[model samples]
Target: MISYEEVQKHVSADDCWVIIKGRVYDVTNFIALHPGGRQAILSHAGKEVTELFSMLHPSDALENLPPEACLGLVDPNTVPAQENVLTESDLQRRAAREIMPPAQSMMLLRDFEEWAQRVLSETAWAYYRSASDEEHTFMENQDAFRRYFFRPRVLVRDMSTGSTETTFMGIETSMPVFISPAAMAKLGHPLGEVNLTRAAGDWDIVQAISSNASCSVDEIFEASSEDQPLIFQLYLNKDRSQSETLIRKVEKLGARAIMFTVDTSWDSKRTLDSRAKAPTSADASSATVATLPVNRAISGYQDRNLTWDDIAFIRKNTKLPIIVKGIQSLEDVEMCVSHGVEGVVISNHGGRQADYAPAPIDILYEIRALRPELFEKTEIMIDGGIRCGADVVKAIALGAKAVGLGRPFLYANGTHGEEGVRRVMEILHEEITNTMRNIGANTIEQLKPEMVGPAGPWVGANRPPYIKQ
Candidate 1:
């Protein structure tokens, strides 16, 4: 067995070593290959990373490491016990968690956000809440939803028989809403994407697994039932072979569809996430090490040079339906249909990629006006600033096959884990049912365009004269 002192000698970037789950690993070679960048590994080099690793990674994270990288297990008796020291922030979070209102009291999607804001760590909250630049698109996403008002047709049909069930790319889902792919769920809760998987199974809803999830795809798949329909959201790697390998693996593991995210070709400025401090280091020399923003650190491996031609590579690898997510314009939607993509998600990366990007709802409206026929050719879906069941109804009325919500579910899972996720689904189900009943629609297909319209005369009004200046 190696002593702890032996690991300390290899702390530099050129010769990094760390202990994980009581085993010594020479991670120098893996540093450059790490998806979270070299600093993410270098910051914790020469230390036992069981606690941190458990929080951010799956149990099998190190299984793929070359056998030669495993020097040996450390002497159990010589290694120091990890202390459960609580910082002031930890105490505050604990107090907030303790006083959290009962689950039954959560009446709306926004309730979970409040609870998460109270209980999550500062860094976790920052990462989930921050949008690109001034967050104009983030606010606009919600505002755009409000621009549409329901044209309720009362007493026209039996409202009590309404159902939210719908098919996504031929897969039946209990609701038209699917959990949008969000990265690093472990930052919100220990179980991470597993919580989402379990809840999705229980609620009979579709869960889109993120490429950058805290849990491994294997782990998330294991948590799901034999027939649970799951979608894999991909962030293509710079290495073509790696992406091909992943596509084949997910297909083999039973992913019903592949949603390739294209909007994040380049990282955007998220000031709030940048301002949050990186995890503190136990090493004394950490003062001299360079740190990266939370968003930039985790996204270093993304292929920024992605182009329309690359879609063929994904189509070549998997027989599953391919979805082009992050389409911001009607023209792009047309292109996706021309390329024979099965579906497209009109999204602005939840307003986290571009500051003034058009909201998904606005894009949906644009399609309705310019190229309504595209909806017939391809399955159109949308996500961004969705907080209620009415929002889902509005999008469906405007011709979206389904709708997606990212931050709401992240907040729900962060606050209460699997239970929180389930509650959010329950609330949305009730709201969607009520909204459908109110609008005189009994099925997902019954939501017609005439049932909804712009909020008022100012629906497409130009900016005020003072603001134009």
Candidate 2:
């Protein structure tokens, strides 16, 4: 068995060398999953693997290698790319000066207070981050998870048996780390929706495309591979025909689900938006957010008069499962559940619509408790302040099946396009795996509210508030 110290050394590529004939080369990443077999990797475990690689074997032609390549000795020609790539130190020297990000995540709550005071355009900061003041509901979200706490049974049998398969809306998702929708993606990055949706395909994560995207719905769906699951987000259009057109197009695109964002009837008055005068994040491509005809022959309409009936209208137009977003109260949850809603996104519209609205996580349990019968029957997803795997764990434990990540992703999409999103997702994935391993929970379903506990100090007894269940 590899000891902790050995693993560290191997990971750091220190004290370990690769040997070929009489030479040495490092193959750290390839060590564990070496196609040449564990013995070949072990052969160079403590030395260099140069001569074996330099021999110009079938491995070098790995791109043309057959499926059987994985079952035999090292192809020698198949030397790992890490063998020739620049080392960490080499890359470090060439890297640009570190520029701290303008926005912070929930993980950096300790620095949150500092971030607020930093001089940034109010609109940028607000739209980018900033939930409402008293922000108690928002703060309580973290606390709520901390309170449930995980309960792992010792010596108990793990019935999971390594398969974390779960089905949602007739589609199979490995786990619930699906995509969250974003508005005016171009405001955050160049490729915008294109970059994000494509990367989602790489990780097998579902990407919910936004209605306000610069790229039209058709383009966004086209960007994804055949295997990816797509969910089209719906925002009520000023004209019902616009909404109708959008829904029909989304259905034609094979979207797995329909998400109707209902939290914002009136535009939110974010202090950030008002103070900063941020640029229009919405796409300039179409005057409207829906798929209606752009012909001047048609007159304009208004979304201000939307009602619950519109939900039914949108549903009637599409065959996909209908999910309502932004349900904060238990009453609303019950109302939607009774309306034959297939899913509910418990959100505060990322604190953009209503200042001081209860954070989505804070109200999640109430929603869960309100519809115990529909809990497993209907899908529940959430977004807003989802930064790390811990936040993801907290969300899942609070009953979120698939969590949507917003601002941070926008920051990434703008910061480095696809690479930035890939990096961000990678971090979240690792954190999710690490969190599960640390807490002794493997799959998303196995994650429970119990994994979280009180932060630093809360000596006082808990408040006897009304819990939905």
Candidate 3:
């Protein structure tokens, strides 16, 4: 049996070891190759990481570890008794789990969000809810959906013919809506991305696995059943070789598409997240606890110089269809089309990257107007503040091939695990069906440009400045 003293001695980049469930693992070689990056592993090097490791990894994850990496068990007598530290976050987690509303009773997506906020720790809530800078654009994303009014036709016959069934990037889906890639789902639930994969399989929707997901890509895929459609969202790393390796792995694992996120070259300034860590009178008793930094900023080999050249490298590396996510302008769309990309996800990182970034919905209209032929050639997707079924219809009418929902699913997973996720999709399914009935559309194809109107002359403050009234 190994001693804890021996493990503690090797805690640097060159030689790092960790204790997991009484077993020691020499992760020196695995550090740089880690999907979440080296720091994530290095932070807990030489320390007991059973709790965090179990929460983030699958049940069989350790079995895949290299045989040589396992350096035997720690002596029960020499190992110190595991401390059962109950901090405020622990209390909040328990409280959140205790207060989860029955999945059957959750009627709306907003219901899950409300309960998730109550249960999540202050730091997690801040990170999930916080937007960049003043959050003007963040609020605008939701409001953009409301700005467009629906022109419903009266006395529509054969409403039963309507169906939300559609295909995205040649992948059949129950509805036009799909789950967007969001990171570190373990912050909300222990199941993390596994919950997302299970729910997507249950409901026949596409699941875009984030590169930054708490669960490894293999773990998420392992939980999925055959015929369940999955895609990968990639953040190009500074190390080109590492990026190439990741792409090949995902391709081999059967990801139908790759969404290369190009917007987040620089990190956004999340002030509320900073405040949650700062000392405050509201939680003076737990100031020391909060100082432990519950939420770590997403860091890794982020390439600030990621450009079109890297796109060429990715195309040559894998045959998976490439979708350039985070496209905000006509110029970028043209560039993506010029590069022969299969699709484009018109997004702004859900308005998390910049304060005044243009809404994806607005950009969607601009793209349709400028390059109408490109829509026929390239599949267009949009995501940002899509809170309801009518919003889904509006996006389709405006020219988006499909829509993505990120934060809502995160809240769903936190509130009710896999069932919560299924319920959120169920809620959207109902809303989309009801919306189709009311709008007099029979099939997704019938949701044409004529069914929607301009935001002009609207009598709401949320309306854009260009729109009157």
Candidate 4:
């Protein structure tokens, strides 16, 4: 058994040892390799960091650390009580328990978000909420949805026949919505991606699991039934072989599709997440901070050399339908078509990758205007700031075969576990049903372009004519 004193002796940067759940981890070699950065783990070196570690990481994260890193368990008699070790998480957990509403009362997607922010630890909240530098594109994603106005048809006959049911990439779904892939679900709940996949299966929807999911792909697949459709998102590493192995594994596991992400060549400067990692007060500059908490998955195995040739390699290697996510340029969409990609998820990495990037909906509009015929060939999808049912409707009307919702589902899982996710799907289903009736559409196919038009602040606004000053 290890002792606190033994752990303390290794606190310097060169030989850091951290205590997590009464066990010691020699993270000296791992500090620089940590995705969150070195200081995040270093700050908790030699401390009883079980609670902090649980809050910020998944169960598998500890397992992923080198086996040799596990020095030994600390003697329980010598350590403080488990309750004392969990002081921070205990407080947050209690607050969450106090504020959470009954599942039935959560009527809208935004309600889940409000509850999640209230209950999640401050750092977790910041990590989930933070966007790229200046956050302009993040704001734009939500605002762009509001700019489009829907034209509701009056005196519709046989509204009961309206169906929200649709198929995405030939996978039957209750609605035209799918869960967009996001990383680190453990920050929301212990079950993490397990909870998400289970909820998606229960509701007959698709879930695109992130490569950096707190839970591994095998674990997530185990939680799901054989018939449940799953998609896998990938971030290519420096080693092409690693990506190839992952592709082969997911295909073997029956993942219906592969979303090859390409927008993030470099990590973003997310101020809120960085500030969350900083010492609480300016005077506490000397405080131990084991990690420099950057946005999770912002800067990791992403290959800078990712290009069309790699895409071709992936396509040739896997029979699974390939969807190129984060396509914003007309040229890229044209290229995707030329390469015969099965699909394209028009996205900007939820505005997490780049500042001032065009919102996915705006990009969808541009693509529709330029090459409407491409939508017929490729299964087009969009995700970013899709908060409610109307947003989904707008995307479908604008030629998206499906609309992906990321943050709402994550917040749902955070606020109330698996049940929260179930409620979110239920809410979206209701909203979509209501919206289809209002728009006089009986099916997803009935949602035509003429049913929506530009609205709100930018309706008729254009660049002001410049005069010589």
For each candidate, the alpha-carbon lDDT, in order, equals: 0.88, 0.59, 0.83, 0.82
- Which prediction has the highest lDDT against the true structure? 1
Model 4 scores worst on lDDT over the 10 consecutive residues at: 460-469
Question: Deviation in angstroms for 447 in model 3?
Answer: 0.4
| Model 4, position 352: C-alpha lDDT score | 85
What TM-score do all the candidates reach, one by one? 0.94, 0.64, 0.86, 0.90
Q: Candidates sorted by lDDT, descending order?
A: 1, 3, 4, 2
Residue 265, model 4: lDDT of 71
In candidate 2, how many clashes are counted? 25
Clashing pairs in 1: none
lDDT of 3 by residue, 1-469 (tens): 9888888999999999999988999999988766455666876779889987876555666776799999999876777777888888779778777867698898888998888888776656777787777887789898887767777886866986668999989999999998999887887888789999999998999999998788888888899999789999998888889889999999999999999999888877666666766668876885543432322335555778888877888999999999999988878888998899999998888888877888888887666555667788789999999999998998897678899999999988887889899999999999998888788886888887656656664346533333234
Ranking by TM-score: 1, 4, 3, 2
> Could you tell which candidate, 1 or 2, scores higher by lDDT?
1
Q: Pick the candidate with the highest TM-score.
A: 1
Q: In model 3, state the lDDT of residue 205.
A: 95
Query: Residue 311 in candidate 2 has what lDDT?
Result: 76
Residue 424 lDDT in model 3?
A: 94
RMSD of each: 4.2, 20.1, 4.2, 4.7
